[model samples]
Target chain A: MKFSTEDLIEGIRSGNKRLIAKAITLVESKKAEHRQQAEELLKEIMPFTGKSIRVGVTGVPGAGKSTFIENFGRLAIANGKKVAVLAIDPSSAINKGSILGDKTRMEELAREENAFIRPSPSSGFLGGVANTTFETMMICEAAGYDYILIETVGVGQSEVLVADITDIFLFLKIIGGGDELQGIKRGIMEMVDIIFINKVEESNLQKAKTTKLELKRALDFIPAKEKGWKVPVLLGSALYNEGLSDVYSTIDEFISLKKKTGSFEGVRVQQAEKRFEYWVQEYILSMMKKNNSVEEAYIQHKKNASAMVFNPSTEAKLFVEKFLSKGPD
Target chain B: MKFSTEDLIEGIRSGNKRLIAKAITLVESKKAEHRQQAEELLKEIMPFTGKSIRVGVTGVPGAGKSTFIENFGRLAIANGKKVAVLAIDPSSAINKGSILGDKTRMEELAREENAFIRPSPSSGFLGGVANTTFETMMICEAAGYDYILIETVGVGQSEVLVADITDIFLFLKIIGGGDELQGIKRGIMEMVDIIFINKVEESNLQKAKTTKLELKRALDFIPAKEKGWKVPVLLGSALYNEGLSDVYSTIDEFISLKKKTGSFEGVRVQQAEKRFEYWVQEYILSMMKKNNSVEEAYIQHKKNASAMVFNPSTEAKLFVEKFLSKGPD
Candidate 1:
């Protein structure tokens, strides 16, 4: 069970499941030593990592996000594609509720030999660019999974982050709007390239149809955020086992279209740039957090602010300038 | 007026229009010396800010965004408030077209002695949270402008950046959602606290009404992103001067509710924290951008990436770590 960077790189290329999972654990580990090893593993496997179709799936708690993903994965498997599932569990930091989102929920996909599901990192930052999640994705892609499905309970910063690393961001809704849509973030609506109105069964069929039209009306107004791709709204009942193919094909159409328009590579570059920017941010903040003077300056400036002697912008600028004055030689 | 920092600060406090414009120019100056003086001027007038009802307005071009803001500003002034308009002309950098958004567009408001209008900084870095905008807002507040109207084209980073500095974020949309909403960013939709469906006069009234209903349906599904308030969709015609009062009152209600819930100050603290974060980010990026070694590392790493020798996560970590290794004396 010992996994080194080469073992990981080889196992992933040859499709070794246990070794792939081990590689993921190393990547998700918080220990500095483990992170070093994980980085090495990822680099060794870099050649194999960009071959898969990476799709990010997100929705609210009861939006049939899990069911739709389950059926979608199974459909992909049936179509001769090996599928790997990864979930970004934001709530794990609070309630450990993400325990319920694992293999138990995607039972069929979990039981399939061609499908591999790794639970969300128990120690992730929950944002879309979780250091470990991004690394884990590289591992999955290198393991020769034909499709990488990243699921997140669309809340907090997940959707925007998901869009950054995902090829096509898919938001699944359970055929209803009313109060259910109340909790949905509009940013999620904007980032999605495809919308699936799931759970359109016997009684909800008409409602789902109407919801589709309404979505189309609103979405039709939204010029394309992504290049050369019209955001499409489709219907499905994951429970009834229907409409999954159309969903799959539409996703296929999106990738091919974006690829043809050069947006596929263009988006990947943008994602890389965003990730680079994020790292610089996190590193600088951490460095300043370690400096006592920055803290003192903030306290002094905030005191001055509360007393009406310093404005917020001035206070912020002063604090930053103080840090820069002491910044690296 | 030949402006000194102290004179500019006093002029702003005493409501001198020329002095206030001078203070804004100093804040917007990229030169280190000017930035220092701007900070001093801002600190001098810090006590006078945080009193006005700061409203951030955004809408796509041709969506009556300018006309809507002009009416909104005038309505506030007519209600016994001194209105100051600071437009975040994002397109100014590219098209140099923000000239039309100045006093010439809002003739009545522009001519009113009580109104102070600053054309969007012709040299502003397109995104709305330009540091100068923050300082300009403070100067306007100190100058006794009871209402601060910040207008931005809804298509860029301006709306979200404006949201960080303003109390209530308003998105102005004309009747139908189709092509008009096309250019609108999804983040703008999510960030807005109130949406005004403008141009609801004569023939466009019905379409506006239906758009309102459709918006309500989607908004109702979205739980309030902020506490103690519901995102309200209002009807308005800035051209006809109808429904402007409702929009104003709804904004008033939002501020009052947020105040009662203590989220008003809570949001301010969050804004301050985000600004601090952004400043640190900009400082680090700038420092690295100036370093030949970092640039060389990036090019080499990127080359390795294109050759499949480094995954993005690995590449980013290596670059950040290189910077961190060289950070702090």
Candidate 2:
């Protein structure tokens, strides 16, 4: 099947699954020919993008992400919104393969008429999510999905990067654990918009309530990193489908409040600015690699150091000057 | 007092404070001329580096990092080793200046003959450490400091980056403060080598012990990210200087074990490899910016999107290709 930019754009605008999947595959592919084609496809679909709300979900391995996402998706669908789920599986350190299969976990959601499910491999790159995940989110948005949910493999500092690329950051945690909240790393909590205590069912109800109070108290000591908004802690159970209505309502209220205060646009603008800076940083690094100036300087400096000859500082400056004087390629 | 690379190198080797400060100032300078000089100075000192043990300490404000480091440094010096404290102060969001003055906080250490103290401004950088901190470490190492302690503003995930650049990561926390452990981010704990329950003096000693045992149990389930090492939880009091000796002994044991097993060299090699990669990345990114490829592509892409003409993916690909083909500057 031949895929073009217009076809993908039209299919997405019309909510065609096959085209959307094909477009994402093209964007995710590493092959040179497919990459160029993907580029062309994105150009055609660019106008239809940025119309959706992008929510990023992250937590530890047993944090009930799939169940919560399913509940959230159902709520959105019930509200007449088309939803797309992009589950980023944790990558293998050795070969960079994704472990969890989102299709299996989100079976019901995958089967929904108004939903699209994408199980993406993290690619084991820095910042947790795949480098292409950001592009994939845009593709989903362009395809007429009004709600894009990005589910990350809850591992390390990558979730923070995931937060940077999303509209709302949702952190999931289980109740009544001996986990060191003080050790939770101040950075992640500061970035969170909402902390949802999951699995508040049956025996865990009291524990969840207790944990919620504890968290509220703890948050008081930590100064709010974000302006205007306070991080809210809520409880929900993905298993029994309890508190999901409240969750949805809270999200709606938060969105409306942010939009009214112009913070919605402000957040998006900040994200875009960061995206721009990251791209520039990535580009410059690529240039240095291609030029071999780094290699030349490294080799010479290593030799000088090993021999205890001229100091490394002098050698580094000389290399930088020589490289700069060579001008643009 | 004109400073040249040779003079700086010689003075640093001879333990001249002025030369050492001048070298760090050069590295920290953003001006083009001073930057060139700094780079040159680094090349000279690169050979004399890598002998020091780099330790990264991080905890929230009121976690007693300065007090802890002072005691730790004094212990290191008492053991006949020179210590250099590179303290990174928390940056003010409004003025972008660091507030915590290390000289005032670590007055005792500052007065020690065998200790070198330098407080670096975070400058709103993500890592919570200064941009030239790694370079500064090298200069300090060359100046005969065998133990280099990097103290970061315990801001969560960014603190992990500080750990990434160090040999050992020590995370500090207070004891028995209403679910203190539950408040810590799991991500930070995963990267920690040692978890010190600080302020464990007369009043909190029992609580600290309980916290340590609880933490040990918690660590069991969390799964260590690094192979062959369990994150050890210890009780300490920076105020009373209790447990300082044990902390130093634990670090020494770890380093010795690593050395005997050949992991010490292996770790350093890996760290050096990462540093090299970062250097290359920065170089290429700068080159891309110089050629205006990013700015042009971004502007063109934005313009096309507004006109309903171009897709973001396609624009990104074209932009990347054009920039890549343009080659290095």
Candidate 3:
């Protein structure tokens, strides 16, 4: 964390794990000085970023997500590829529980010299986990981690947010009879590019196949995520390490298909454009929360709102106008 | 449309149909002069608004929603109650094809002197259908329409928006064997206050009963919307005009229960508060879109973003600062 910006950039480029972690910590910092430093650090290594394949893995709590990611990460390392895993921890925000770092769960991958696993950045700056995770990913990419796996808690808005930054979104579903019934809930089926039916080893093989068929039928009602690619449902056993090659192959197929259709770059371009909007909105909201004058105005505004003497648009405009008069500079 | 503000206010208080329609047209207009007038008009009607019991009705395209509303509205009118219908035409903003007015479908209600049915408002600023619908509802309430039925296309984001503004959300389910299966899909089942199994006239009676049982079991997993109320599934035949009094009784009971429990006023106050945030976000986005300098900056920013020369948050802040410098005055 104490390294100069130039040295940090050099360390990351040289694949120094300690420096990579420090750089990620710097980006995750909420302090203004750290942010300024992080910006400088990001600027120095900007060219080295965007070389990795970002994949988002999501499922409900007990859906074998950790086990699957562990095996998948180890498999990639065995193939002589450098891998990095970043998780967007939802517990701290939703339940105020302890951090759910997969360090213990992914024991083998944690020990793999060719792999790196980072816990979800602690809640910082309005608890903006997505932004922190994204910044951490850039640091990982600069550190020469080629395959970046982003794991999000499948509940709430985390999965949708993860899908925006990642290239392919893979949904891991446990082999259950109610697969079709639960898949379409929360509109999750419409967002996924691939479905992995995990825990399909031993006696569960037939049930998994039936679930695949049911899922395919259920998906018929929902539109495809991409134009040319049909979301293939593949069976897997993360515990027994079965049917993962097909998973990577499907991802490769998706990447090439998206590239061929030019949607790969197209989606990324849109994300870049969305980033501009997000920054302005987040900055405006945070500043309002911090400003005493705006806070006072909002209290008065709420009273007027309850009395039906004022409307939201006019009051919001006034709030912004007053904030502007404070002179942001 | 040409009436003075005092005249318009008096006309609406007297339930003058022509003046009420003109006031709604004013609210639906996007021009600056009209918007200024609309705000003033809304202020005058604010005391009279929030008098209606708002209900949102949604289903898939072929779900007999129009037919059900027709018979149900007639039933309400027969019971000496005033009814108003507002259909949110999704085609205008999304599909751009035919208008989905309930005029033809609800012939009986359309002919009733005690009933007032308005088609969806034409596109206005930012193509905000929900805003127009809310404004229109206020105008209708000023004219003393006590029972307000809002019809939304159930497929997309519209239903969720409708749910926020209404008192009770009613989901109409045709007596399909897969009622329970499809209802839980997309988390829509969890949001409804009541589910109506429509078209259970003769041959579909048995199937409807079975569907109701299955739905009740499936709903057991979903938490209740209110502390003391459970979502009841009922069978009805809209075409035959049978079992509709029970529907109104259930609604009346729900209103009395919610009023007694203080949640009726509670939800409305929360909605008023949310309106403030929504207005701020929408106004900010719209103003940025209209500013030519900001537009040019965005184009340049996108280029820099793709080249990794800049990130979204920093560029967005710079863009906002530039916009602020133009002087909002």
Best by lDDT: 3
* Residue B254 lDDT (model 1): 89
User: Which window of 10 residues has the lowest lDDT sum in candidate 2 chain B?
Assistant: B121-130
- TM-score of each model, in listed order: 0.85, 0.72, 0.81
Q: On a 0 to 100 scale, what is the lDDT of residue B197 in model 3?
A: 84
- Per-candidate iRMSD: 4.2, 7.8, 4.9
Superior by lDDT: candidate 1 or candidate 3: 3
**lDDT at residue B116 of model 3 (Cα atoms):** 83
Model 1 misses residue B83 by how many Å?
Answer: 1.8
lDDT of 1: 0.73
- Model 1 misplaced stretches (Cα beyond 4 Å): A1-3, A62-64, A97-108, A124-129, A175-185, A197-240, A286-310, A313-329, B1-4, B67-72, B99-103, B122-131, B174-189, B193-243, B289-309, B321-329
The per-model DockQ list reads 0.40, 0.16, 0.27
Q: Model 1, residue A259: displacement in angstroms?
A: 2.2
The better-scoring model by TM-score among 1 and 2 is 1
lDDT per residue as tens, model 2, A1-80: 38767787788778789888888887776555676676676666666677888888887667888888887898789889
Candidate structures ordered by TM-score, highest first: 1, 3, 2
